[model samples]
Target chain A: MAVPTTRTARRGRPGYDLESLLRIAVKLFNERGYDGTSMEDLSRKLGITKSAIYHHVSSKQELLRLAVGRALDGLFAVVEEARTVPGRAIDQLEFLVRGSVTVLADRLPFVTLLLRVRGNTKVERDALAKRREFDHIVSALVEQAAIDGDIRADIDPATTARLLFGMVNSLVEWYRPRRDDDLHTIADTIATIAFEGIRLPGGE
Target chain B: MAVPTTRTARRGRPGYDLESLLRIAVKLFNERGYDGTSMEDLSRKLGITKSAIYHHVSSKQELLRLAVGRALDGLFAVVEEARTVPGRAIDQLEFLVRGSVTVLADRLPFVTLLLRVRGNTKVERDALAKRREFDHIVSALVEQAAIDGDIRADIDPATTARLLFGMVNSLVEWYRPRRDDDLHTIADTIATIAFEGIRLPGGE
Candidate 1:
């Protein structure tokens, strides 16, 4: 769910904003971990009252949902946008991979936090469900690519999709965004390794 | 870092063993994060007194070290074994990927626990150091393969290694061992996607 930018858009807080609050919460969540971070800790870090945090969001879980949701939404948006690529499934799959790298670079913290969740809470479970949906979409794209004779048919499509995304998703572990231009290079490297690796010999 | 099988193999407890304790510790750590689980939790899970738990290992951190150490040791052993393979670096790289999949499958819980650590504790930092060492070894091998003209020269070897191992390491998330034979199939799939991905056309 899109977190309302403010409790009410017309009456804006002069000093603290909801987006800033969410950003700090996410940073703390990423650093100390979701379970380890408390609202009181957020208050201490943000130099604001817990009452102010509640005024913006209902609970720590809400912050988590918004943070994790941004990542899932970005990925699903890539999926939906990629659906409109007017070409073979393999082309669309490459677009999906490249777009995902951009989203990850753009929303690194959110995606990093999303990757770390283990379905422990309701929020985590919901995030995981969305992730599974995204995985299914990628797997379907791989199968279609195989049927189109664009990629190797020997590997199981689901496994191929998993391994492909495994490499993509792994960027969250080590990649630190040094430049905006680096995203495309990273995307190309991954796509070249993944798609070209799986592609049949003819298109080369 | 080999955990002595028992305090003494000859004088084993009739009901429990260190292996079983480490296994249970790993399960709980995976289920309810290492930081979240307490000594009391372990004692209750094992149906033993906290004193008994202490008698076996110095502290919870020791359990974590032992647990994560198993994964690192298993991986390093694979690294050492792959070194003896006499072939082009590309061939050896494929062997490393396949052997890693086996290690991950055989030591699923330990490897799972290892991936989740964030270096918050000294034990965790040590584990991360070992992981980096493993990654460095793989990257060096990839560099050699690239220099040997077995793989693509356009991509950076370290990034290639990261992406390759990322795909292999991700098996820990969704892959549950069904049959021992499936391990071979899984390993072949990873090697195909990774090595063939970077392979020169015509296999020259």
Candidate 2:
């Protein structure tokens, strides 16, 4: 593969392009898992020396940070955009959940790794901290919805938020994007089941 | 610690009791995570040599197998009992969901480890296979419930099962056994929200 003009010489040519390196890293991370992946393994996969990888990124943890940050940035952006939307609390929550699912589906590998990382490394820990902040934002929305009588008040907001994300996070586990499974359809299905629920609201 | 056994070891001593070793192993597995833990770490934690651990179990993978098998057994039993219960499909599913939550809270550490494993080892692979089987069974139940016209037909059964288990699995992420947070109470809350949902029935 040809190195793009953006690359700089660091003693020698960058052994692998940055874009190729990231795609390979994400694939390996998904395959062997984040903790199971090693620098040597990544080098072997990319047909590049370990030094070549170091020239591109400092370490394996740096790769993880780059990958999970992609997912986290997508999620936090959804929360930020949804909060500004003019609607009822439930409507805002609906927009947030649907948009989040679409992001998760689009960035499946990155978000899958993000969800699985248990803070074993600094990168993983930072990802988790940011993840908790996102959860807090969603939980606050659930709290507002509950207070507005848009949602049931019997359950605590934190528990409700956990349940909501639980439903959303499971998307990473089972959502295989088919040629037919468009984001709009997937997001609509998730939102409908989430808001109105699997029970027919009118008479069931 | 004094060796309580009446029989003396032919070697230096009976290094560590099996029960005590298991307790320490489970604790370490929970703390460092299963993939991150090593035999050397386990030995140091037990204050015993690596060879001494081998005297009880062949390998670290054996300990993982034992730990995950205990959790898998609990989950499979819940599904089996649910299958035999005489009721409509939704009722049986409700029973299974509550039972699984109770088992999960009861065996929090083991199930937490089981949930986190990424098929990096043979033991992990086996655990993942069993987990998939359990998911399949639950999906079948979800389908049956939908067919019976209990759950709405619009949402796919597989998706609903994922949503249901997602709610159950999130318990491990945050749930702590507090004085106020009883297991049955939490299980009841999960089932209620899962089935009836957070929406007030009949618009209150």
Candidate 3:
């Protein structure tokens, strides 16, 4: 499967490459659910033959794998990138929260699908395992932050991490990229609300 | 259908009632997608015939309606109870948060199913509408809190309400009723993290 470089081809028919096809597939999966969607549905939605879709991805499961893999890859990459440079544990944790929101916003459809996977099949189970690994890495960062005295020491680190990410993860349910609201503003608001509580300075 | 007042009946087969039947149905619905579960599946799991199941709820949609309605009723009651006495907006907001977490903990299965509804059927669409209403009421409280200068003024109240509830709502995904962790502590942790942020007092 080749990445789509151009939006259109010389032919009048709508031209779609692997990436474009997967985007549509992920959107459909999110709307109709993975189990409810079929290759025929994808074909009909794309206005292309199933053979054309098969030419890119082997099967429906492959599309599911590719879609969720995109989300997981982005998350793991954030942790990997954070590892190369040195910083305080709290700073690293902040970076992760910011980067995760960016990834979530950038790949909203894919991340939404990834989060909704129910582990009904082998492919879904694999995705769930990868998700757990990502969660573990984040949990460690929370522990280190607490140990470094960067965050409150009262709450358990694992539980703190879960609540923090839970807030961020809920973006998929209601967040829509607005023309006026950029991703950075959204990310900053999340960070502020998560780190500072929403209380006015010296008010609470 | 009559609500079960007694936990046990005189029948030798360990008689079940409507509330108990709905509990089992909700668990099954959560495990298997609501659309995927059928009366036969519920009967098989309950060790009863479909006819016996019909003695309670008329159909699967009724089961879903009853389950989600349970969650909605709890939320509405909280808001209704709050209106009886006058208090500061922030206090009202806090009360809503605390009450919501308690409700979520007490009715985890029902709320979990409520949150996961995708509006595929009329029952689901109705559930979604009720959820939106709940969000609106919370958002109003948040707006009032910001106006009262109890919370930060920089962020939009609607956005703050969404993220705050998002953090609280995520509890259904990971929180289990445990011997050591009491509901008040869990609710306090949520309220503290949300209103106070998790950072150290003097630390950023």
Candidate 4:
């Protein structure tokens, strides 16, 4: 679990705050990778001592927990919201895909780490389990879409979900937030291409 | 750039022996990560002295260069061959996509590093540049396919290429070799899902 940020009203060093430490750690982690970065590395980047880092958080793993937990929260929220929406299965799938890309674009670093982890640490293992949970929900939606006779039955729903996410996950590699190409546009384009390409039955 | 793996063959305590060391390094690099692993870690894994490692290769960067070069060769080969195939642009795109997946599946470690590198090192930077060249080629093919009116013309080629590779790159996360699932079937299914989706188009 993430360290309780909202409840911690007071701090030993006013300038060195929890939120700021997280921002610094995430940046360094992205630059050097999680395993490459050490507590000393974070302190050096922050212009503080390792003891100062300990003052804000327990260990390096705590930072990972906070970062990945935030990412998991964003994704799970999208899935839960998609489930309650009233529409055809394909329509719901479209909403889910669009929502996912937007979230990814917004929280790019956390999502990038979430996508890249190899289950080497407990935090990584937790992120993976949460990811599988998200996949399970999407698989169900794909199945429902197929049953609605909107998508083809030839392929399995599990396979379809993986393909859908494969496209979505690729965003971490190249997606840069631009003035012209914003998150909304990227999400809409991804959904349109995915839905148009896979909607069931041949084209007119 | 690689110290010419073959050229160093004559020197005993063999400079060429570095090739075997490089292979061992790349294998470890893929499993643990370049940042996560160390020279000492590599020496331990290879059952060789740290001095022995230096005899063949100068530094970790050389090993990265050799590994990424292998991946770039595989991908560029696909683009070069697809350009010569006798077919419409869409057919060529399909062939390229299928071939890219197969190549990635075959060279999982190299491509996995290619996909995972964040451009933090010179080796990663070079790999990213080569990857961009490959992307440019695929985007051109997507543009040609759109011009031929074989596929939908509404989506931009850049976007199409991202989605295409999204499906292909997702292979590293889940694909396993020597497994029960037929790769031929997997490749065909991806093509089907890409060209014609689960939903049959309106006309045919």
Question: lDDT per prediction?
Answer: 0.82, 0.78, 0.84, 0.78
Per-residue lDDT of candidate 2, residues B44-125 (tens digit)? 7766667677778888888888888878999989988998888888878888999999889888888888887878778899
Q: Could you list the iRMS of every candidate?
A: 6.3, 3.3, 1.6, 4.3
Give candidate 4 regions above 4 Å deviation: A1-14, A198-204, B1-20, B201-204
lDDT of 1 at A132: 89
lDDT of 3 by residue, A86-121 (tens): 778888888889999989988899999998998999
**Ranking by TM-score, best first?**
1, 4, 3, 2
**Which numbered prediction scores highest in TM-score against the true structure?**
1
lDDT of 4 at A91: 76
Task: Compute each candidate's TM-score over C-alphas.
Answer: 0.88, 0.84, 0.87, 0.87
Error of 2 at B189 (Å): 3.3
CA displacement after TM-score superposition, residue B120 of candidate 1 (Å): 2.1
Best-to-worst lDDT order: 3, 1, 2, 4
Clashing pairs in 3: A197-B197
Candidate 4, residues B1-204: lDDT per residue as tens digits? 222233233335333376677677878887878877787898678665566676766777877888888888998888888889898777778889999988988888888877877687888898998888888888888787777767777677887788889988898898889767577777876887777765645311
Where does the lowest 10-residue lDDT sum fall in candidate 4 chain B?
Answer: B1-10
Tens digit of per-residue lDDT, candidate 1, span A60-172: 89999999989998999999899999997887888898999989889999999998898879999999999888899889998888777777778887888888889999998
Q: Which ten residues in a row have the lowest lDDT in candidate 3 chain A?
A: A1-10
